[model samples]
Target: MPLSRTVRCICIEISKKRFNPKSLEKLEIIPASQSCQHIEIIATMKKTGEKRCLNPESKAVENLLKAVSKERSKRSP
Candidate 1:
């Protein structure tokens, strides 16, 4: 299934980060609440202890920042 506009936007924002752009393809946006519009964006690094939680709002940007920081840490030996 094709991704929603909101998901696409979030993916685009995530792709802008320094981490592997292909990782965005693995991103999953799941609805957190059936009643409300709250959603969760999840991204997991392969074989690495990296996971991120983000909302579609401003928190998404913050989460992406954290993801980048984590990516940097993983890259650093």
Candidate 2:
């Protein structure tokens, strides 16, 4: 709706009677993560007090973290 000339106050409502939410929902664009989904991993780590950081490759730190977690579990009281 385009109005030419001057106007006082123009209120356009598109929720209840005018526009559909489904059509508008289809127009939204979002980015997705590649490889493993990071958000889930982050949330899990937050609960368990574990943090994951990016390393140069999956060789050094990845193996290091797994070994540390395994060693930590092996430690006795």
Highest TM-score: which candidate?
Answer: 1
C-alpha displacement of 46 in model 2, angstroms?
A: 33
- Tens-place lDDT digits, model 2, residues 3-76: 63323212221122222222221121112245322212111122344323322232433444566689998995
- What is the number of backbone collisions in each predicted candidate, taken in the order shown? 0, 0
Give candidate 1's whole-model lDDT.
0.54
**Estimated TM-score per prediction?**
0.34, 0.25
Across 28-77, the per-residue lDDT of candidate 1 in tens digits comes to: 66654543345556666565646655344434445666787999999999
Candidate 1: give its CA RMSD in angstroms: 12.6
Pairs in clash, predicted candidate 2 = none
Which residue runs of candidate 1 sit more than 4 Å off their true CA positions? 1-18, 35-37, 55-77
Instruction: Rate residue 48 of model 1 by lDDT.
Output: 69
Model 1 misses residue 17 by how many Å? 7.5
